[model samples]
Target: MNHDKEPAKTGTKAGARGLPVLESETLFQGRNEIVIRHQGAEYRMKITRQGKLILNK
Candidate 1:
C-alpha cells in the first residue's frame, strides 16, 4: 500500500515536485499504452464502459 502523498489529477502518483513529466518509464514496445504509478503502486488502465479511463490498482 502507498502511504506517501495525495493522488494526482492523472489518478496516478505524479511523483514529487520537480520530477519528470513522463510517469511511466517502461512502455511495451509497439504499444502506445504504458503502465502508470498511482498513489504509490503501479497500474494499467483501459477505456471504461462509459468511454472514460479507469485505473485498477
Candidate 2:
C-alpha cells in the first residue's frame, strides 16, 4: 500500500563538475600585475595580491 515515489539513483557520473572559468586583461606592465587563464583553471595576480611579479622569458 506504500507506493508514493520511485527509488533514487546514485552514481558519480550522474553529476557535473563546475570548474572555474575566467577571462582577464592585463592593464599595467610597469606595475607588475597580470591575469591569465591556465588550462581549465583561472587566476588573478598582482604585485600585492598573489605575489612578486615575474615577467615570462
Q: Candidate 1 versus the native: TM-score?
A: 0.29
Error of 2 at 17 (Å): 36
Which segments of candidate 2 are over 4 A away from where they belong? 1-28, 49-57
lDDT of 1 by residue, 1-57 (tens): 244744332334446764434332223333444467877888876554464556666
Which numbered prediction scores highest in TM-score against the true structure? Answer: 1
lDDT of 2 by residue, 1-57 (tens): 125644333334423665433322223435556555677565665665665554431
TM-score of each: 0.29, 0.27
**How far in Å is the alpha carbon of 2 misplaced in model 1?**
24
Going through the candidates in order, what is the number of backbone clashes in each? 1, 0
Q: What is the alpha-carbon lDDT for the whole of candidate 1?
A: 0.50
Q: How accurate locally, in lDDT, is each candidate?
A: 0.50, 0.46
Which stretches of candidate 1 lie above 4 Å from their native place? Answer: 1-33, 38-40
